[model samples]
Target: MSVQVKDLKVYYRTLRGDVRALDGASFTIADGEIMGLAGESGCGKSTLGRSLIAIDGRMRYVGGSVSLDGAALPLDDQAAMARHRFTAVSLVPQYAMSAMNPTRKIGKLVTDLLRSRGIAPDTVLGEFRRRLELVGLSTDVLARYPIELSGGMKQRVVMVISTLLDPSLLVADEITSALDVSTQKAVAEAVVEFRDRGFVASTIVITHDLSILVQMADSIMIMYAGKPVERASTDAVVSSSRHPYTRLLLSSLPEVGVRYEEHRLSGIAGRPPSLLNPPPGCRFRDRCPLAFAKCAEEPPFVEVAPGHSAACWKA
Candidate 1:
């Protein structure tokens, strides 16, 4: 395993109470694997990604451990984690256009970034130009300001920068959400290209788009509220899901050729439960059609098929 997380619990302090953002998430990502994290809004997907790199002021590391390449990550200590920030783990944040500095030229920004890490920009300048070309950007883009590039261009630039030192693990949080359909496809393909070219050993693509996940991810992990509801290979999760939540989610998606007029599609009726003071037992009980009296007790995330695990009473 390249990445192993055991019982990871991260919470956010609020005036109301501690919001259990990530409660006991455990999983592993193998070398060269692209794991897709799917969940509804505020389901702790972003919290899990951010916790691995940097913990914000609101987030409190309540428990658990994260290991990369057989070494434990000092996620709680900002100073100690500085050594592993960009080189060991990198992130392509949600907003790429706003990620860059408008005042500095792209080359100067890269130079400053390398210098901050005690790396010589001159040594990597040739490689940087090659990478820019690899992403279909001109080498002359190095002289341009962030404001000069379009949204897609800026996103690709951020991708290049994030993987400059070839981080072992890359977290791409909704990187394709803001782009048009064609641009989204291109950017998504570029992400896979990064892995193929050895720019990053493994990646975690966090998004709610199951269709996109089907195109890019090797494995899919579904989260409800603050806990994992299902985990399996992409094929198994899409075609043989045992969890009601996963089944409903997949069914709700409209395919490319599926027209609403031809066949009416229905969305899940009830909304996801609030994480704050969540109800006892399954968080999805209120919305699950197959929920029963046994749902009063929390269901363990157990393997129903080889490499397919779901946390549901019926499963």
Candidate 2:
């Protein structure tokens, strides 16, 4: 496994209390695998991704371990994690389209970032330019300010820089959330190419857009209230998902040729449980149609079929 997270728990420090955003998340991503973490808003998909690299002051590591290629990550220590940030693990965080410095030209910004990492830009300048062309960006973009570029252009630049060091793992959180359909496809394809070309050893793509994952991910892990409810190969999850939440989520998506005029589109019924004070047992029990008295107890995430696992009694 390129990445292994065991009982990982990360919480948000708020004025009230610690919000259990990432509670007991455990999964593995194999080398070269593009694993998609999908869920509704506030389900901890982004938290899990951010925890693998860096957790800011507001976030706290409650417990658990994250290992990359068998080496444990210092997720609880921000300063200690610095060495692992770009070379060992990297992130293209949410809202990456506007992540660049407004005052610095693209080239200067890259130089400053490399210097901060103790890497001289002259050493990787040639490869950086080549990567720009690989992602359909022009070398002339280096001279332009961030504001001078379009949203898609800015996103491509960020993707290139994040993977410049060929990190062991790349945590991409909602990287395509803001792009147009065509641009989204382009950026998604670029990510797959990064893995195919060996720029990153493994990738964890965190997004609520299942369609995008369907396009690129090798496997899909469905999360609810910070815990993964199901995980399986892309085809299995889309066609033969075992968890109730996974089934509901797929049913909610609009079908390609189905008309809402005849068969109205479906939607999941209830709001997700609050992470601040979530109830015991299955976090999805309140919204699951197939939930029973057995749901009052926590279900273990166990394998049902070969290579497919789910955390529901029905499964």
Top candidate (TM-score): 2
Error of 1 at 113 (Å): 0.7
TM per candidate = 0.98, 0.98
Residues 71-105, candidate 1, lDDT per residue (tens digit)?
99998898988889889999999989899899999
lDDT of 2 by residue, 104-149 (tens): 9999999999998899899998999999999999999999999999
Local distance difference test scores for all models:
0.92, 0.93
In angstroms, the error of model 1 at 272 is 1.5
Candidate 1 lDDT at 49 equals: 89
User: TM-score for model 1?
Assistant: 0.98
Runs with alpha carbons beyond 4 Å of true place in candidate 1:
none
